[model samples]
Target chain A: MTSTTCREAMREAIREAMLADDRVFLMGEDVGAYGGCFAVSKGLLDEFGPDRIRDTPLSESAFVGAGIGAAIAGLRPIVEIMTVNFSLLALDQILNNAATLRHMSGGQVGVPLVIRMTTGGGRQLAAQHSHSLEGWYGHIPGITVLVPATVDDFRGMLAPALADPDPVLIFEHALLYNAEGELSAGSIPPIDRAVVRRSGRDVTIVTYGGSLAKCLVAADQLAGRGIDAEVIDLRSLRPLDDATLLDSVARTHRAVVVDEGWRSGSISAEVSARITEHAFFDLDAPVLRVCCAEVPLPYAKHLEDAALPSVERVVAAVDEVVNVRA
Target chain B: MTTVASPVPATLAPSDVELLRRMLLVRRFEERCAELYSASRIRGFLHLYIGEEAVAVGVGAALEDGDNVVATYREHGHALVRGVPAGAVMAEMFGKVEGCSRGRGGSMHLFSVDHRFYGGHGIVAGGLPVALGLALADRMRGVPRVTACFFGEGAVAEGEFHETMNLAALWTVPMLFCCENNLYAMGTALARSESDTDLTVKAASYGMPAWSVDGMDVIAVREATRRAALQARAGGGPVFLELRTYRFRAHSMYDPELYRSKDEVAVWRERDPIDAIARRLTGAALLDADALEALDAAAMEEVDAAVAFADAGTDEPLSDLTRHVYADRRGERGPEEERT
Candidate 1:
């Protein structure tokens, strides 16, 4: 096993996939000569050349659609749409073309396309740039959504995603790029099951991507208060691992959802609804949620802090469920 | 202007006559489609490729039997010229199942896998990348197939157009980027939208060989397409051709024609490709008045048969509306099976 940052893990995973399969290639705004905007693909252009590590013009729709096209033509293309917020421009291609091509083509074609986009808010990038729209994406059918929260997961989940016949959206959290952990980058796992980060019996905390770390920190604090919280990191978002979530929630009998998207129509709301419907009989109390405050993320550090879901908020949400209903 | 020795002068008489016949058919099919639209037989967004028939017929003629084609919404001409029956296109307009794409594609989404005609994309500049990929696949497989993607000059504003071209040229994919410069994009004219009205320059910037030709002349479009198609098929990589032309009708059925004047449309009409070809054929004694009438009759017969065939088509059952939403044939396994 080798120690590496989450970003390096991603770079290594992409390099391995490209080396293994000629079909695998990548395209995005600064993916080539300038390396990746986040440095995930720093030395890639030098190794793979421009054909494999393509840098696209400012048009997200074109590159995204091209990726979809390449996938349809049997190339496993990984399209990077800089940020989830900017992905709105390529929504037509992503939703209409990539997501729907296989079904629309009556199975004659499958878009084995992986779109890696940075999601969640924390940086002072404000309204237009900062957004957590993975929930909105999860609503669409014919696509698989995955969020790798750990260095090991960042490296392991790529092969399964690349092997899938349909399109997959890999939401990489902007905050975790620099986070370091032990990782075995050379190997890949095919399982789509959610991994339990910390096992506790009192309450279950379900979350993915940016909110996973916060939930873990909240879990540690809750351990201090003698409130043992079980943490479930949802690796696959679209084909949600409901059995895993329900099994954990059933054991704990209480749950708290942590999502970084704004309150209204966020993934947290959807998770809560799913838990209520599927694991309702086992629940002792209502499903609690810790989501970002409902205003557009602002550029100021303090306001941005207030706009996102924090450990304090997660702890408070746990208290409301464990303290109030305990 | 890197001119190749002017392609041996159009010595092929049958080919020239076929071009005229095909152009006339698209013109008539769309014209009749316009009339039917007034009668409420066709509905939804209808983008007509009336004046731009030469581009479709010309480029489509050079495409080999197995070559792939990806076109835009104004695609009846492209689909029909690519060998999809006009009846199916008309029925698609009427939302009938007999239509190409099983009537799901209508005017903007006609698709026929049998012909390798990918689709009639509704979004502007949407088909470029798909074309690049098609070429890429052919290149990888060592198949001598060419993927021709057709779009309007207005689509140049779309980022995908440039990005796709760059990738195609960079990767040396076998593709022909046919820009049907009909001068207007819906209400937005090319001059108002493009900073440089010359589209070939845009392709040249990406380091691809490009040319601008008279789209108003069927012979010119055919010659340009034949050369580009041959070059792309011969492993010369992607070539960009800007067919300089104008739209005779409004952008779509709903467009009010507020953007350009009737006088402008009339001026371009004087250069009508169909009439030009017919006149040239008559002058050369390759086609007499009788042969010209015969060609018009055949086209009319083809359109008539297509319309009747569409009218006989059945509507897709509501139960199967979700058929192709997920899997092609083997769908995602049930949640339990997916885990395994």
Candidate 2:
């Protein structure tokens, strides 16, 4: 086992995938000589050469759409869109082409494409650069959404994501790049299913991506206060491993969904609704949610911090659900 | 209306008669589609290629067997000329399971993986990048295949058009950007939409070879596409061809076509691609009046067969509505099996 930062893990994963298959190549805004916006692909261009590590123009729509085309042409292409905010420019291709190609072509064509984008708020990148809109992608049906919160997942998800027949979008938390964890030697995490990060029986905190770390911290704080919270890392966001979530909710009889996106139509709302619909009989209390305030993510550090779900906020929400009178 | 009359001076092939047959096929097929649309047999937004048959047939003739094609929503002609059976294209419009896309994509989204015809994207300029990527993939694999992307003049206004043009030129990918400039973008005229009217000039700004051709003449379109396709296949990088054509019908089944005058449509109709090719064949004594009638009759018979196929095809079951959302898990082991 070895300790690796999420950034290094991601770089390692890209390297491993390229090594495994000649068809795998990386293309994005600054993936080549500029390393990457976050340096996740720092040394890749030198190792793989230009054809494999393509440095594309600042045209997200073209490159992303081209990635879909390449995928259709039988190449596994990893397209980086710089950030989730920038991905809005390529929404036409993602929604109209990548997300619809398989079904639109009636299963004759499948775009085995993987798009990696930095997501979430915390780095003070402001309104344009910050905002967790991975949920918007999760709402899409023809694509798979994955959030690799750990070092193992950071290294693991890429290969399986590239191998999947349908398009896959991987949201890498911008802040998690620096976060470190231990990856067992040569181990990669599964792309599907939610893993129990922290097991408890009193309440279930469902979260994924960047929020997983905060939920774990909140779980620790709840434990100190005599509240046992089961933290579920929704590794696969689109399929929403209902089995793990429902099992956790059934055992705990209480739930709190933590999300960085606005709550109105967020993944948190979807999770809360699923629990209400499927596990209502097992629920001892109403499901509570801790989500980002329904305003554009601001630039101010403290305001941004207040806007996002914090450890205190998650703990408070968990307390509300756990302490509710039956 | 100002299509330059620079028909190539080189000798026209006897197979040129085949061009007339194919264009006649598209013309007859689309004419029947118009009648079917009025009869309410095929519903949805049906964009007919009535006056634009030459562009699809000409470009289709230039493309080799392995070359890729990405076209716009008004692509029944493109699909038919690119080797997608008229029966399948008609069945797609009929929304039957036997359609090329299994009826999932009606008229605007015809697709056939076997023919390498990527799709008939409904969104303007959406297919450009996909075409560029297909060429990029072929080039990377050391395959000498050209990807021909067909879009209307309306797509020029889209950011994807500019982005794709720049990337294709910058990367030197083997791509043919075939822009069928039919004078209008749905209801809006080209003069109203674009800042500069010359599309070839706009494309040339990206440093790729660009030119305009008489889209009303199949011969011109075929020659231009052949030149561009050869340039792309020879690793000469991406080239752009602006096929200056016009649509004789409404943009869709519902369009009133209030954008242009009937007189303007008449001037374009005088140079109808099929009429021009048939006239050429008759002048050469290779085709007579009776032969022309026979060809038209043959095309009508083909369209009838297509209608019969669509009429006989079934509707997809509701149980399979979500079948293609994600590919079915095949022999591949589950994710759990990968945990070491």
Candidate 3:
């Protein structure tokens, strides 16, 4: 095992994919000489040359659509939209073309394209850049949504995403880029399944992406208070891995969904609804949720922290669910 | 309407005769479609390419077999010329399993990978970027191929059009941007919409060769497309062709067409592309009245066959509704499996 940051792991994964396939090329704003806006693709320009590591104009719809087109025409294009905020500019292309092409064309064509974008908050980048809108993409059908929170996932998800016959969107949490973890030489986990990060029996804490760390920290805090919390990192958002979620909920008999997006009509809402619908009889109490405050993310550090789902908030949510019948 | 004298060649080649035949086929087919729509057979946004048949046929003539085509909703003529069978196109409008897109996409989204016809994109200016990508792929692979993108003048108002134009020129991808400027964008006239009605100027600002052609003149469009396609194939760069044309019918089946006058339509109709070509052919002693009648009869017969095919086509089963949302990856193991 080797210790590395999520950025490094992702950069390595991209390098490995490019090296393995001549068809795979990375294109986005500032991906080449500028290295990447987040510097995840720093040394790639020199290693792969400009053709493979292309820096595109700030035309998200055009480049994203082009990526879809190239993928249709037999090239595996990895399009990077700098952030989830910037990705809105290309939303039409992503929703209309990439997501709808295969079904729209009656299985004649499939967009085997991979789109990578930075998501989530905590950097004080303000409302435009800091909002975690990956949930919005998760609502879309036809595309797979993956959130790689751990270093292993950061290093692993790209290969499977690139290999999929349909379009796959990978949301790299902004906060986790600098966070370091051990990269094991073991087999990479499947991209579609959710993994249990910290197994416990008292309460189930469901979260993904940046919130996974907070949920884990909250789980540790709950352990000190004699409350065992099973932390589930929902790796894939769209597919939801209901079996894992339902199984954990059945075992624990309680649940708390932690999400960085707002509570209303969010992934947290979906998870809570699923647990209630499927595992209603298994519950000791009502399924609770810890989500971002329904407001634009503030630029101030304290305000941003208050707005987002924190370790304290997660712990409180778990405490509420665990102590419901007590 | 400003009438440009017919530039028909004195001695017509067999290929030239074939061009007239193709245009007649599109004309007759769409005429049948109008009848069918009136009778309530084909449904949902039937954007007829009645007056703009020459542009699709002309540009189609320049494209090689390996070339890719991305067209807008008013693309029956484009699809028919691109070699998507008349039956398939008709069945697509009929929402049949035998349709190009297997009844999933109705009139506005006909697609056939075999003919390299990308789509019948409903969104204005949506296909431009896709065309750029197709060409970009070919360029990266060092393949000599062109992607012909067709959109109406309305697409020029969209940001995607500008973005695509700049990228196509900047990347030097082999793309032919065929803008069918049919005077009005649905109801809004070109002058009312764009500050500058000159579209070629907008295209030229991107540092690419852009020009206007009499869209009613099929030969002019064909020659321009050939020249542009050659330049693109030779790695010169993208080229934009503003085919000055008009749609005789309403934008779609639902359009009342209250924007223009009957006189305006009549004036443009006097310079009808099909009639102009046929007249030129006759004047050159290439096609007599009897041969013209035969061509019309043949076109009508083909359209009749297409209608019969569409009428006999089957409806796709509801159980298979969820298929193709994500490609079925049950049998094949991707590269990741091998690596693991």
Candidate 4:
């Protein structure tokens, strides 16, 4: 096993994809000499040269649309949007072109483009930069949405996304960039399944992206209080692994969905509805949810911490589902 | 507006009658489409490319094999000139399985990767960046391919148009930005929308060479586009051409013609591209009245056959509604293979 941070894993994935395919190139706001806005592409320009590691103008729509066009032509372009909030500038290209080109063209065109962006609230970046809108992207049809919370996923998800025939949007949680973890040798996880991080039988703590780490902490706290929580890290967000989620919920008979996005119309809401739809009879208690408050993520550290899904919030939700009287 | 008067060389020029026949085909095909829309045989939006036929045919004649074309929703003419079979394009409008985009694109989104026709993009200025990218890919591979993007002057108001121009100019990508300045954008006129009425001026502000041509004149469009394309292929970077023309029909099937004066339409119709070419051909004694009638008859016959083909075409299966959403990754025939 090799230890690495999310930043290193992301950079490594780009390097590997570039080394493998001549068509694969990276383009974004400050991806070259400036070393990327988040420093994920640091040193890639020197390693891959300016052609592969391109630094584009601050025009999001043009760059993103160009990426889609390149993907349509013959190249596999990995476009970094700096952050999920800034991706709104390129939302037209992402929604109208990238997501709809293949189907709209009646299968004639396939945009094998990878759009990586930072998501979630933790740093004091405030409302503009801190919204976890990967759920918004999950609503798209032609695009594959992936949330890589682990070091392995951060390292491995990009290659498959690049290889896929359709466009893929990867939401790398802003707070998890420095989240150091060990990646197993030659053991890359698939992009379509939700894995059981901590298997148990009392409750299924379902979460993805930044909230996975918080839910794991909540699970550890629950175990101390005589409750065994099965933590399921949802790596794939778009085609949600309903079978694994339903199976875990059936075994545990309880679930508490954790999401960093706002509760209403959030991915957490979708997962909760799915469990209720499929595993309604199997549930011993009503499904609970721990999500960020409906208000826009605040700039103050205390308010931002409160507005986001925390370990304490997850623990309380888990406790509520577990200790409920039948 | 500064107009360039470069004579199109005889060797590279298409026969005068051939250009007229191409335009006649588009006119007849779209007229049939209008009739089909009225008869309920064609559903959804139908934007006719009647008056703007010369821009597509002229520009299309200048393009060499393996070149890319990115067009707007009013793309029936562009699709036909780019070599997407009339039958397949008609079938697409009919939403049949045999259509260019397998009937999924309908009227506004005709696509054929085999012909390198990217799409009939619905959004204004959306195809510009895609065209830039196609050129960028070719430029990176050292392939001397020029991507010609067709959009209305209204797209100039969009940020993507400016952004794409800057990028294509900055990167020195081989691209031909063909602006069909057809007076009105849906209902809004160019004077009502753009601060500068001159479309070529907007393109020139990006430091790219730009020109204003008489779009109603097919020879002018062909010559200008040919020169621009040759320059781009010769490492002269991207160039823009504003084809000053007018659409004979309403924006779409549902428009009530509430925008412009009928007199203005009449004035523009006096300079009809088809009539202008037919007059020139007849005046030159190269095309007789019988020959012109024969050409028109041939176009109608082609349109009739296309309609028959569309009528005979089958519908895409209901089960396959979600088929190409992610593209089939299973078989050996993948998206990569299709591009190659």
Candidate 5:
């Protein structure tokens, strides 16, 4: 078993995939020489050579489209958008081409492309640089969206994404890069399902991406107050692990969803919708959400903290869902 | 007959006369298709390829057999030149069971895997990325094939256009981006839309070689496409060629010619590809009036047979409407192990 940070685990997983298959290559701006803004692609240019470790021009659509093209051509291309905010430039390629090609072509062509983008805001990088749109992307059909929370999840999610016969978008949280965990050698964690980070019974805490850690901390806070919380990390965002969410909410009869995306039409909203629809009879309290404030993320640390979901906010949300007074 | 015959192009050599015949076959075929649309024999948005024959004629001839081709909705010319039989293309247009896309794509959408013509993509610039993808495959295989993508000038404004150009240029993949600059994109002309009128400059700005040629001239288009195709297949990387062409008719069957004046349309009609080629042939004494008449007669006969073939084709069964939505796995040996 190797003790690895989320960033190292991710780097090794992609490196392993590239080394294992000639068809697998990484393309992005600053991915080659700069070794990625988060250094997840560090040492890849040296190992894979510049051709495979492609440094794209400041054109996200073209490279993403090219990656889609390569994916359809039989190469398992992994496109790294510097951040989820930058992915809007390539939305046409992702939505119109990559997502629809398989069905449009009558299943003749499968887009086996992996698009990995860093998501969530904590670094005070300002409005344009900081965003979490993975929830919005998850709304689209025909592609899988993975939001890996732990180091193990980071190491385990890449292979299935590369192996899937459809397009997959992995939203790696910027704040989780340094988070470390133990992993058994050759551990291939499943991404198509949710995982329990902590177990509880009084209330269920559901979250993913950068908010999963905050959820776990919130769960610990709930435990001291004699409220048992079940934390479910939604690893895959698109084909959301509905079974896990429904089962947890059904048992606890209470739920709280935390996400860094804006509250309106966020994944939290979708999860809450699903819980209300699926686990309505079992729930004693209304499904609640602790989402990012509806504003472009602020640059200053205090303002930035106010914008995103914090551990205190998660705790407050859980308390609201659990401690109802007459 | 409700169907009209497309004129036979004259610049064609005996070998190219056959090519011109085939191109006219596409023009006439699509014209009949438009008639079918009126008759309710075919449905969906119908985009006819009335003019702009030479661009497809020339570029389609430049590529080797089985080379991947991605085209737009106005793609009858591309399908015809890419070696999809007139019967199949006509059948597809008629929404017959034997159509290239199994009747799933009526008029606007057409796909022929055997011809390697990916399909007639309806979205303006949607085919660009898919075409570049086919090139990616060829490059990876080290095969002597180039993915030739056909698109309109309207697609130039799409963000995907810039994105795909940068990717293809940065990666240096073997792709020939053939821009069919037909002046108008659904009533919006290049003059009214583009900040940069010269589209080749945009391609050149991507750090790749580009060429601009008269698409109405089949010979010139063929020569330029051949040269560009050679550069791409030889691993010289992608080339963007903006073919200055026009549509003799309105954008689609539904359109009214309110944007351009009738005089403007008639003026461009004089420089028609088929007529221009014939004039060039007569000057060289390579083709006479009788030779031109004989070619036109032959084209009419072929087109008649194509219409009959399309008429005879059957429609797809209602049960099969849901058949091709997704691929079914046969459970291949190996790769059963969890990848991650």
Candidate 6:
């Protein structure tokens, strides 16, 4: 196992995809000479040159639509929006063109494009740069939404996304770029399933993206408190792996969904609703959620931390569900 | 405004006659569509290309096979001129499974991949960026081809128009930006909507060669598009042609057209493109009154056959309603084959 940062792993993944297919190219603002907004594409410009590694102007709609057009014209383009907030500027193209073109064209055209954007709050980037809106994209039917929490997933998700023959949006947590983890040499995991990061019997702590690491820490903290919690990282958000989630909930009989997005109309709400819809009889306690406060993330470190989901919040949520039955 | 006598070719060529026939086809087909809409045979929004036939036909004459074309919602004329079968277009308007988009997209979303006609995009200024990318793809692949994008002058008021223009110019991609300036954008006149009225000046600001042509004259539009398209296809970067035209009909079936006056419409109608071309052809002794009548009958016959085909077309089954949302790539290959 090679220890690498999530940023390095992502850079390596893009580099590898470029090497694998001549049709694959990277386009975004500051991706080439600037080495990506988060330094995820450092040194790629020199390796791949400007033809493959392109730096675009701050025109998200144009470049994203261009990516869709290039995908239709038979090129695999990886369009990187600097942040999730800016994706709103191109939301028209994403929804009207990228998401609807295949069905609109009656399956004659499929957008094989990958759009990667930084998401979530923690480092005090303020309201505009730090909202977890992956759920909004997950609600879309035509595009696939992926949130790669681990270094391995950050490295592995691109290949499958590029090969999927439809538009795939990868939401990389801005806070997880510097997180270090072991890069396993195993085969890349399928982008359609969820995996149990840590197994337990007391309760299932469901989460994804930036919240996964916090959930893992909460599980360890819960273990010391004699409350064993199973941690499930929802790698894919749109096609939420219901089987994995329901099976774990069936055994545990309790769930605490943690998400960085707002509580109302969020992915956590969707997950909790799905659990109640299918596995309501098996649950001993109500499904709880540890989501961000319904406010724009502040710039202050303490306020930002308070707005986002934390390990303490996860631990407390699990305790609430675990104690309900005790 | 008075109609200026356009310089007609001394002798009409066979290609020029074909251009006039194609324009007549568009005019007749849309006239029949208006009647069908009134008869409740074709529902939903119908935007007629009544007086703007010269733009589509003249521009289409400049394009070759294998080149890409992206157009806006008022795209029946574009699709017909691009060689999408009249039956397919009519069936699409009828929302049948045999339509070009398999009845998925109605009047505003006709698509024909076989003809390389990308879409009939509903959003204003939406197709420009996509066209830029299409050209970018060909440029990256070292292929010499041009992607022609058709949008109304209203699209210039959109940010996408500016953004796409800059990107296409910066990338030096082969793109032909065809702006059909129909004097009014929906109900808003160009003067009321845009601060500066000259669209060619707006395009020229992006460092691309821009031209404005008399859209009512089919030969003028054809010559201008041919020059611009040849330059773009020869890797001369992007070129913009503002086809100065007018829509003689209301914007859509729903419009009362309170924005413009009947006198203005009558004035523009004096320079009717089909009538002008027919006059030129008759003056040159290429088309007699009987021959013109024959061409008109043939167009009506084709429209009749298309309407019949649409009438007999089948509706898509309810069971397959959710198909093509995402491509069904299941059972094709395992994830193992996708690994690097």
iRMSD values, candidates in order:
3.5, 3.8, 3.9, 4.2, 4.0, 3.9
Point out the worst 10-residue segment of candidate 6 chain B by lDDT: B1-10
Give TM-scores of the second chain, every candidate: 0.93, 0.94, 0.94, 0.94, 0.90, 0.94
Answer with 1 or 4, whichever has the higher lDDT.
4
Q: What local lDDT score does residue B116 receive in model 1, on the 0 to 100 scale?
A: 82
Minimum summed lDDT over a 10-residue window in model 3 chain B is located at: B331-340
As a whole number from 0 to 100, the lDDT of residue B269 in candidate 2 is 84
**What does the lDDT read for residue B302 in candidate 5?**
71
True contacts kept of each: 0.42, 0.75, 0.72, 0.76, 0.45, 0.71
Error of 2 at B41 (Å): 1.3
DockQ by candidate, in order: 0.38, 0.59, 0.58, 0.58, 0.35, 0.57
Docking class of 5: acceptable
lDDT of 5 by residue, A7-123 (tens): 999999999999899999998889999999899999999998887898888878767877887787788899999998899988888887787766555556678999999988999
For model 6, the stretches where C-alpha displacement exceeds 4 angstroms are B1-11, B330-340
lDDT of 6 by residue, A39-137 (tens): 988899999999889999999999999999999999999999999999999998999999899899888888999999999998888999999999989
Which portions of model 3 show Cα errors greater than 4 Å? Answer: B1-11, B331-340
lDDT tens digits by residue: candidate 4, A1-326: 88999999989989988999999999999999999988999999999999889999999999999999888888999999988988998999999999898888988898999999999888898889899999888878888899999999999999999988888899999889998999878857678789999999899999999989888888898899899999999898887889899999889999999988888898888899999999999998998888889898889999988888889988888888888865
Per-residue CA lDDT of candidate 1, range B1-340, in tens?
4432244457557557888888989988888888888888888888877778878888887888899999888888988888887877788788775667655666788877778888888778877877777787787667888898999888899877877888788777889998888887888878899888767777888887888878877777778888887888888889998888888888888888988888888999898888888888888878899999998988888888877887788897766565555553344454222221
lDDT of 5: 0.81
TM-score of chain B of 6: 0.94
Better of 3 and 5 by TM-score: 3
Q: What is the C-alpha RMSD of each candidate to the true structure, in Å?
A: 3.8, 2.6, 3.1, 2.7, 5.3, 3.1
Better of 1 and 2 by lDDT: 2
lDDT of 4 by residue, B218-294 (tens): 88889888899999998889998988899988999999999998999899989899998888778777788999999
Give every collision pair in model 4: none
